[model samples]
Target: MTFVHAGHGATMLFMLLLLLGAGAVGAAVLSRRVIGLRILDYPTGRSAHARPVPKGGGLAILVVFVTGVPLAQMIWHHTPTLADKTLLAATAWLGLFSWRDDMHPMPALWKLGAQVLAALLVAWGSLGILPHDGTAWGMLLGRSLWLVVLCNVLNFMDGLDGLAAGCTLLACVVTAILCLHAGAGVDTWGTALVMAVAIAGFLPFNFPNARLFMGDVGSQCCGLVLGALGLHMANLPPLAHGWALMPLMLSGLLADVGVTLLRRTMLRRPLLQAHREHIYQMAHRGGMQPATITVLAWAATLCGAGAACALAGGVIGLPAAAGGVLALQLAWAVVVIRRVRHTPGLRW
Candidate 1:
């Protein structure tokens, strides 16, 4: 299960710096050009912002990652397999539809269908390398659905400035570390590093205050890359059967999205419809500052990452880390719910 080490540390660092520069310049330019391009997201009843903002800033991330990672792979002399190539390709595939959606909204079905196809592409590529056992087809269907769900998970959570981007940046960093510890392929860690910096390049335009939103374009691309990397790690020999660590690392995000979706379904609300009932939204409505909420979310994600690493290292059992991650998120959820309930006009 040894993957040929891709490149020297110094070389990878140089490549990342180039990507960071490209992403920053690209995002800055896109932020300015989006207005001229007329790709603006107006305030909606479900929106957290009060004013219209230029959207599709994620195009910078899309372009930077779609162009940079493969080139890095080639330079490092690590020829990516068909699955690896497809994972990267699928990001651009989905980006096209999402970029268009940001400019002109489309039916939910259209976007969902696009996401499914992107997910299927990754799954199909993965199946080539995966064990051809009785469960292979099941894995294909399951992984495909997982990728689509993850795409929407990030999309669903992309409300406040810096939240989705910040959380994703941290997740990529954490996943990269785990990949290194487990000796996963360079394609896994390399993709993770590229994604983190790419988002880092975009973060300045997004966080503390947002001049540009990643919109569906940026968020969905983040989801696809993150999800695909998680699957890649799971199928690696060292991390095989420890797939739970992937989700554990993303506990805060999954909790927020999972709980929100469940509440909506229980209340008979439309699942696909956008709303501000997410726990982060509740905290915001309950007077939490966006920066504060985003930082708090980052902290929770770090805690989950710590637990995941502990589990991967056998410092803690899976059940303990799983329960700990869930408990931490549950505590945060309770705080948000109570704050919303205590607010004079707010409801949870």
Candidate 2:
């Protein structure tokens, strides 16, 4: 149940730096005015921006991941496995659909269908990677659903600049740390670091100021990869109790997306219909700066990560960490609701 020791710290460090440096350069090139003109995001009634901007900056991250991972495998003297190819292929499939959607808006049902198909691919691929439990069918269904939900959750939370991307970057970094602590192989932790730097490549243009947007292409890819990695970790025998790692790390995103969708359903609002009603969106509408809101979300995620790490270290049991996470989310919801209470036209 243990992993090959992740030796060659120097080599790992070089790989990380190479990915980051390349990603940053790619992001810079993609941010050029001529390049951005290829796909523009025009402001709508529900949009946070006031003008059209270049979108699809997430292409840099996608490119970095697609190339960086294989190179890392080579550097580590590990052969590329079928599972690795499956993961990349599925991500590319979903990314293609998302790219098309960003360039020319597609129907909600169609996008959802694409996401489901990609999720199924991931589930099927996981069967080979994860150790067999008796309930294979159950695992397949659950993993597929997990990927789909995360894909949509991140897509929903991508309303403001840097919100989704920044949060995901944080999750990747923390997940890598947790993976190392749990004695996971270099494949697990190293890939997580690659994802983190990939996102870091895109953040400079999207955060604080909106020079470019990641579009659906970047957001959905981030979600799918995150979901896949979380499932992989959960199936690791040594990390059996680490099942809650991702949820705890992404508590802010899950809480915001979960509550918003539930409230919409209760109010008879169309579930897939786009709107600016998320807690973060509501806070922004209430005059809070996007940077401030995103930072708050980052802080919540960091808190959750700390608690989750405690569970990983056996310092606290799963129940204790899970309870603390729930309490933290509830407190966050309360504070956000109170802050935006007086914002006109907000139902909650």
Candidate 3:
């Protein structure tokens, strides 16, 4: 019992350190103003913010996360796993291109290509593209597709302040719980705990009227990390059916992006064109304040994630519990869309 308590304490302390370090680094990055310094200059046709803000705040997150994980391993006397190495390499590659994009506008095709390459690197390094029990071709294609879709979905959902960070925090907490309950190795739970802390530390500066944004650097890297973690969770021996949690965990963002794309396709809108069509944006354009809408979304995500974690932890059965939570999430999305649409002066 003492050993277990020690482990938990160590994990918590490590998380706190990472969070503080990441937040401080991000704040410092924002304070710089020099020629050739990368900054978000102004609102564009695709943006929601009206003023210029420092971008690449995710650089701080990546820096802290990258350094923190290895340090934790050293403190705990565990060797770095292959998955850890793969994550580091993938983050480095993605961060480079994302930083470039944040500094200067890059062609969409070029950025997309870099994302694809980075996803492939993760797949190759982590051996994470498919379920171990599945047939070779099917697993390869399915995993690759899942990685690509999730990576882009997270990137798209970064439209609002703190939304992606908040959502990822909820997901990581749930993942941590599930991992701990399943008796998975310390690395799994440790990684999730560390990520949750890092995001929490960064959230205050990002919520609503953000002082600095995660930009592409933060969002894409987060998406990659989550994708890797999800694959890792699904591969756990005790958690045979864990992949089922992905849909519920990501339901809100997936539904918004999926439905909006479908609606636009039906209306013959150009899919590549950017607009304030996301539900969060519409809610803000309506009478809802950004902070209020962000909180509401966070609340819904917490509930869904909690329910999923409960089910995964065996506190509830899978069939009824997962299904019910997913149903509620879909209903909530519908309600948000209807309210936003009905509000006067709301566009998209």
Candidate 4:
């Protein structure tokens, strides 16, 4: 739906600036603090980083992007709708519980349940993915499950430095640009940009022999927000909506994780077990530099997000944009899996 509450272009720009600056500073400061406190993550069998590194640095993002962005909206008197209010509460709860988990290990089921509850609140109480006219129970159920599953998968895919943060940044920025270009309302543009800038703050400390890891805190927080925002954009009122185009934003991630799981399952491997057989991980094991693999995955994300945008904006003549993106991701996954130049020395 077209929102017309007077001029918001300038306000939006100002908020973007605030989020970006705050996120970067918060991340840098929090990284130092975390390191000093010895809140570190040691390498494990299912791990990515080689050395111990500070974790829970995502609190900087929660403060600057998740909590701070909404606070700024309130200060600017944006008059948040119930949907916005729900988003605020949900983001906070997800970040809060995840932060708790970062400091002290929590039951896996508890985290999964929190994720499901967060998704349900947004999907049922706030941003209904289906319309109000008919029986949307099925759609809501599917959407709820989708949000929770995607949130976990995205969290799972956060296997390497800068991988999750960078993919999220790409998805948010591309979606925001597309929404703006399509003359979409401030809702999409504002939320997407806020997420992008916040992730930017955390990204620097991640990747390349990092200062810290986003840990489960950053991963889950970013995943939940990104999933919600994608749903928001996809469910935008009757007009100018593209529910089908939404998943393409994370096509690369979904494809890799999905394919990897299917392969393991076919081999009779326990599905619940943690392993490093993801295409990106395989690429890393195949002597590809972590940076190179991350860059390639990010490039795939860019292409997929761009295609999704094109589909959403009516630039594409067909409804096959999501398929196109998925095909690319699948092909990339295959290449990475097949091109292992050497067997992994580490117990994967």
- Using lDDT as the measure, which candidate wins? 1
Residue range 125-190, candidate 3, lDDT tens digits? 567344465576566556656777777888888988888888988888888888887887656776
Quote each prediction's TM-score: 0.92, 0.91, 0.85, 0.87
lDDT of 4 by residue, 142-209 (tens): 76787787778777888777888899888888777766765665556677777777777778788766
Candidate 2 backbone collisions, by pair: none
Candidate 4 lDDT score at position 301: 82
lDDT of 1 by residue, 1-348 (tens): 123334466676676567656655765675666646666788988888999888898888888788778866775678889888898889999998999898889999999999999999998897876647768878888999989989999998899999889989998998888888888766888788778877887888888998889999999999998889878777766663467766887889999999989999999999977788899999999999999999998898899888878887778888899899989998998898788888998877
* Evaluation by TM-score, superior candidate among 3 and 4: 4
At residue 260, what lDDT does model 2 achieve? 88
Ranking of all predicted structures according to lDDT, beginning with the best and ending with the worst: 1, 2, 4, 3
Local accuracy by lDDT, each model = 0.84, 0.81, 0.73, 0.74
RMSD of each: 3.4, 3.6, 3.9, 3.9
lDDT of 1: 0.84
Better of 1 and 4 by TM-score: 1
Name the weakest run of 10 consecutive residues (lDDT summed) in model 4: 1-10
Clashing pairs in 4: none
Give candidate 4's error at residue 265 in angstroms.
Answer: 2.3
